[model samples]
Target: MDTIPDNIILHPIGVIRNTTKQPFLVASAAGLTMQGDLAPTMDRVRESEETISEVILKGEFTELLEGIDEYSHIKILYWAHGVPAEGRSLKKVHPMGRPDYPL
Candidate 1:
């Protein structure tokens, strides 16, 4: 089997600033179940539709965003810094933690 190299490294180029203070759902350390009620979760989702977040790039990386305003939409990649280490190891999960969905 191929082994991953040990010298890999990553650095954040920017940070997202938003008003959201809590997550819509919380997963157990084992990633088997989600805590919180579905109604409130949906409410948060609705609230987020009207929320605006700012993505501030580091001073050194600011130039990389030149001409970004010309695009109507863009894709963003982010790290889930709040997830527990064990939760990151989950191989499968129900969509939106809805048990009715197949894993």
Candidate 2:
């Protein structure tokens, strides 16, 4: 594997404040399956809806977001805490661990 460069830097601009206690999820068998079958009931519950979440900006950057609510959609990039920048690599993933779907 190639070595990581030292020039990169990342600083958190804001936080995703939500009611989610377990803020981490993956395609682990324990989390996505029951008796080797897809949990259809749970899957619908996990599907996103118009839930409330606040993107509280940092104190210094609060002024930078002056007219953000005018847009219909706002793209937010959340930094996964404790996950490294170079850790992402996925050729294919069975969406929700169902064999029929590979994303």
Candidate 3:
């Protein structure tokens, strides 16, 4: 066995306004329903030739939604998980269900 040297480091950029301090509420509410209201800017849903999708901009971040309608496409980054956990590494392939190759 060999020890690996650490070369990369990570730092926190900002904190979230919504916090789940209560344990039971977080567990029971998991996957049941979503809280809070959707922003009005997201009212205009866009549809492609084969698919339909809405641009959701919620909460305090809604203030930055001004003048976004002029763009044809937008990129969004999000943190899906509120807490980190030990899980499988990043995978390039489907977990044994895909019939086609994925890049």
The per-model lDDT (C-alpha) reads 0.79, 0.58, 0.37
- Per-candidate clashes come to 0, 0, 0
Best by TM-score: 1
CA error at residue 68 for candidate 3, angstroms: 0.5
Clashes of 2: 0
Query: If scored against the real structure, what TM-score would every candidate get?
Result: 0.81, 0.59, 0.32
* Order of candidate numbers by lDDT, starting with the best: 1, 2, 3
Between candidates 2 and 3, name the one with more favorable lDDT. 2
Colliding pairs, model 1 = none
Candidate whose lDDT is highest: 1
Q: Candidate 2: where are CA atoms >4 Å away?
A: 1-8, 27-47, 82-89
Better of 2 and 3 by TM-score: 2
Residue pairs in clash, model 2 = none
Candidate 2 per-residue lDDT, tens place, 12-83, comes to 888887665442334342333222334653554465354578889889999888897788988888766743
Model 1: per-residue Cα lDDT at residue 6: 72
What's the distance in Å from true for residue 39, model 1? 2.1
lDDT for each residue of candidate 3 in 17-92, tens digit (9 for 90 to 100): 3333322211122222112223321231111123443445445667677898899987655453543332213333
